[model samples]
Target: MKALQITGAGEYGIANVPQPTILDDQVLVRITLVSTCPRWDIAMLGGKDMFDQTRPPDYPLPPGFPGHEAVGVVEAAGPSVQGLRPGDRVAALEHLQGQGAYAQYMAYRERDLLKLPDTVSDRKAVSTELLKCVVLGLDQFEDVKGKSMLVAGLGPAGILAIQVARLWGARVIGIDVSPERVAAVNALGIGEAVLADSLGDRRFDLGYDCVGAAPSVQNVLDRTNEHVVIFGVLRGELIYRDRFWMNGIKLESHKARPVTERYRRLLLDVLTRPEMNTECLQTKQISFKLYAEGVETLKRQEAVKICFNPQEAF
Candidate 1:
């Protein structure tokens, strides 16, 4: 099996790695599609613990297959597994020290795999992982009705967050530098998407930081009138205690939680929504031959959400 292996900090490549065998409680899955989580991957590459660091190192430490969002078909099931069987289409939680899904096959615990309805497509189901993260954030911020909200980045996470905010009945605003992304948001009827730089001192009731760039943090401070929910992966020493303190602002941070009870319900809610399931469509598919090129595209913020097709090489 070919897996995208992160050998060390700042180094990762798609190599022919051994396929995973199912354990007593684990099920073997043939992955149909896997989305790129560049923020999470970049954090690990930069030697930062964005959750899943306390788990006592199951597969390996520091460097391993690092992707949490995936959609797949079950190939085999362990003896103890009851609900899931071979040939069942499922979406598996790929975080929490699990095998990477950016390859042909991976093994997961039966509990980690959720049986998807026949209505869901592989891309849409895999995309729900990003929605799960947004749902987690929404769960944390109680009662956002009628209040205005802003999503500071327009990536998959940001886009989903926008839709969720609107679904919760909040008058939402989405901010990003890319006009192309803004257009996509408009076409999808998610929210009022605009370029972050184009806005001139318009204040928001609640704000979200999805980019994690230093400037993005500052953008939150500049626009937020009350609270800011940071659903994105924030890195580096960007802080403004005074700015928040003076305005009586609140900052809530979120991390990936696929195994916990709180996150499980949130994931279910997101999966149940039809509007969120089909939010954005990529213009180009990144094949394995262009793996390095895709990585560079993510690093440069050129691609909104890029998925590497392993079969393209096979």
Candidate 2:
């Protein structure tokens, strides 16, 4: 089996690795598509010790796989696994001890799998985890309809957040450093796009900063009026201005929240509506064999959602 491995701190390499052996209660999936996560790259670049709890205590294991968003087909099933069998297409959460969505195959506990509906495409199915995170954040606030939301960055998560916020009937404003991304979001007519640096002294009711930079987080605090949601991963200290705390603003940071069964069912139900049109979430599509290229493509600030087919080389 071919797999992309995080060999050490700040390094990644491709290798033909041993296929996973299945247990009686495990499920094996033939990976079809996967997307790169920016936080994973930041963790690798900063050294494994940078993250507090999320980083596995055992640092820098040999040839570890690092991906979480993926879609696949169930190629084999364990004896104890019920209701799922070979050829059942599924999308799954890709965070665990030894597996990553970057591999040709992954073995998972049967309980973690979410069977994809026939109405959903593989690309949209791969995005469930991403959408789930946004839904979790949005669920925290109540009755945002007709209220204003300012998403301060238009990365993959930011773009989805923009759309989801709009779907909830909130008037949305999106900001990004990339002119191309601003143009793209403007074309969608989902919200108003603004340049991050151009917001001299404006404020909004709800603001979200999806850029992981400490400065960007501070900027979100500085520019937002009342409620601020820090949705992106930040590594270092962000200094806030003295008046920042005096604004009577509620600050919410992203914490680890498991997808509850209720939310899972809600996500799948909303996804089943064929007219939802998830294609806007994707910015680039590359073959799965070009995994390294996919990783590189997402490094660009303008890239929204980069997908990999996993069956061909770059």
Candidate 3:
């Protein structure tokens, strides 16, 4: 089996590694599609420990898989793995165990796999794991119905947030530095899209900052009326002024919530629904051999969501 490894800062290579062995409660997945998460993966590649600071900066991370959002077929199942068997299609939540998904095969606990519907294609199903995280972020909001919401940063997560917020009956406004992303959001018919620099004298009841920079946080605090949810991973310092303190504004930072049976089922249901509209979020699809090229494209903000097909040879 071959897997991706990060040798150093801003460096990665494909390494031939042993195939994963499953435990009694585990199953082996033959990865079909893997989705790139730019923020986390890019940071890790640059030698920044975004998740945990205590861990040493070691080269060639364990499992060495950069992608966490993946959909695959069950290649094998262990003795205790019931209800799931070989040939079953499933979405893998590999990030929960600090494992990687950018490989031909990986082992996962049976409980960590979510069976995908036949109606969902592998390309769309690749977004399942990240959609679950989007669902978790929406869960953090209070009484969104009839309220106005602003989503700063029009990446995949932000775009999904706009759609989900609209489904909740909120008047959504999407802001991004990219004109192309703004146009895409406008074309979705879910909300009003505007350039970040042109947001003048506008205010929203709730704001979600998908871009974790301090400036984004400041933009949300400057325009939102009530609360702002920080959904992106922040690596910089957050500084505020006296008005921010006096306004009684609430700031909440959110990470992907724990996946449970109920939430998993809900996410699948939402993804399968016609009105959810996930197709617009997928900007590019590439092969595992071009993984670095895809990452570079993402770094240049040329694509929103890049899915990889591991079966394709270079």
Who is ahead in lDDT, 1 or 3?
Answer: 3
For model 2, residues 193-249, the per-residue Cα lDDT tens digits are 888888777777787778767778877777777777788767568766567677667
lDDT of 3 by residue, 1-314 (tens): 87787777777778888988888999999988888888766667767765764452477776545678888999999999987999999987544465688778888898778898898888767877778877787778767899898899989889888888888789998899889889988887857889999988989989899888888877887888878888887647776667767888778888565688878777787778777777766688876567667778888888886877776632
Cα deviation of 273 in candidate 3 (Å)?
A: 1.6
Residue 73 miss distance in model 1 (angstroms): 1.0
User: Clashing residue pairs, candidate 1?
Assistant: none
Better of 1 and 2 by TM-score: 2
Best model number under lDDT: 3
If both were scored by TM-score, which would come out higher, candidate 1 or candidate 3?
A: 3
lDDT ranking, best first? 3, 2, 1
- Please give the range of 10 consecutive residues that has the lowest summed lDDT in model 3: 48-57
Off by over 4 Å in 2: 8-12, 42-64, 79-83, 239-248, 273-277, 287-293
lDDT of 1 by residue, 86-147 (tens): 99998866443655666788788887777888877777777666676677776666878998
Supply candidate 2's per-residue lDDT for 253: 83
The segments of candidate 1 whose C-alpha lies over 4 angstroms from its true place after superposition are 6-14, 40-64, 96-98, 236-248, 255-266, 277-283, 309-313
lDDT of each model, Cα atoms only? 0.71, 0.72, 0.79
